[model samples]
Target: MRMRPLGRTGLEVSELCLGTMTFGTQTPPEDAHAQMERARKAGVNFLDTAEMYPVNPVRAETVGRSEEIIGDWFAKTGRRGEWIVATKHSGEGLKAVRDGAPISSKTIPETVEGSLRRLRTDVIDLYQFHWPNRGSYMFRQNWRYDPSGQDRAETIAHMEDALEALERQVEKGNIRFFGLSNESAWGTCQWLRLAEERGRPRVQTIQNEYSLLCRLYDTDLAELSANEDVHLLPFSPLGAGFLTGKYQGGAVPEGSRMSLNAGMGGRKSPRVFEAVAAYLEIASRFGLDPVQMALAWAARRPFVASAIFGATTLAQLEHALGAAEVTLSDELLEAIDEAHRDHPMPY
Candidate 1:
């Protein structure tokens, strides 16, 4: 895997980041450890997780189990320093954590401590707020998104408060850099602006959903990322297994994401299948693996720091790692663009 700069933080990360959302749930502890070891050997140095994870149906009982699994791996292998780990602080509406509390000054310190304890690490490489307290347009929310109810002054105050809290964490050596997830362009700009004005830690990355079926970040957020150097850590780069062609032809394989969550987190739609078919056809025509094509496509985006991908099994992870060597020809890229024009906002 090639290394890329994580925003302007001067920390280099792998082009592909291993996602651990399935580590403690669908994937067993031994499998999770093996995946981490396999990824490390494959040259992946970045791992992303969240406090409220192992989600194929995120339950309160299983919360933080993913981190614990990773911590076990770190303890057993004694290879904590070999990778740059990134995890998130759950924002408002996640009832499993802090009773659905929003991220604020009160939450940062304890949250950081909890993650540190679970990960068996002293400091986090990238600590991300899972989402803004003001809400976000991600996760298929764009269709009905409304910004009219937002309070500008209140939002700015929250950003300042959060930044101050994050700065304290930095000073305490609890976290080295800060990031955001499921945030909008305006929200990201405010975070950056506040950090600059207040002399707090600047936002280094934004982990949002970006894939062949989801191009929501291609416009204003893309522009902001390019101009400000707030690189994107795109999750679901394979469209939540859709782009892998596993969900094609309306087949819901047992133990698949769609089998567990019928709606696939609102990613299921007739158009989504059509979009997947388009990309799969392109891959078939070029004699390429669809999974590698989708992942490589996301990793090759100009503003991407890393394309975060999750694999429920070792076979899946090995197939995904092949993307590191599979470069999209210019012709293949143009074909993908043409298909995107034909089927935009698939989900």
Candidate 2:
């Protein structure tokens, strides 16, 4: 697998990051451990998860099970230093997590402590705010995203205080770097500005949803990511299995994510299958798997540092991990471009 720099930080990560949000929910612990082992053996050095994970139907009961699964692997294998583990702190508005408490300076230390204990580790590689405390446009929240309620002065003060706390964590070797998720370009720009002004850790990456169906990160966030040294760790590059032809033709496969979370986090639509069929047609024409095609397209994007993906089974993950080996031919790329133009945004 190709490795890329994580923003301005010297740490290099695999071009494809193994996402573990399905660790404890759909996947049993033994299967989860096998997936981790397979990913590591397949040359993936980055493993991404969140404290509020195992999230097909996120509940208060299974809040930290994903981290605990990884913790078990670390405890059993004793290879904590073998991989770069990145996890997130939950933001406000997710009822399952701390009643959706807003992240602030007051929330940093305790949140980090909780993650540390759950993961059975002394330090987290890249700790991220799962979502902006103020609010974010991710997970199909864009149509109703509003910024009128935020207090700019209070936000800046909170950022500064959080930076100080993160700096202390860095000094104590609790975290190597910091990042953001479900954040906008403006917020990221301000975080970079403050980091430079105060000599604190700049946001190194932003985990946003990017795929053929969801091109939300292609415009403004694309420019900021390219210029400000913030890498884009795009989640759902396959559009949550929609791009894989699994949910095409209106056949909701049993045990699929859609069956669990009906809306698929605002991804369900009549047009989604139509778009998937178009991509699948292109893949079939070139003898390429639709999964590989979607993944390669996301990986080739200029601003993407790593394309994060998840799978419920070892065979599925193995197929995804091999995407790095399939270099799309120019002819295939043209076919994909044509398909993308035919269907712009399905969700």
Best by lDDT: 1
Where does candidate 1 clash, by residue pair?
A: none
Per-candidate Cα lDDT values, in order, are 0.94, 0.88
Model 1 agreement with the true structure over 110-140: per-residue lDDT tens digits: 9999999999999999999998898988889
TM-score of 1: 0.99
Instruction: Give the least accurate 10-residue stretch of model 2, judged by summed lDDT.
Output: 246-255
C-alpha positional error of residue 278 in candidate 2 after TM-score superposition, expressed in Å:
1.1
Stretches of candidate 1 exceeding 4 Å from the true structure: none
Tens digits of per-residue lDDT, candidate 2, 15-116, equal 888999998989989999999899888888998999899988898999999999999999899999988989998987888988888787777888888888
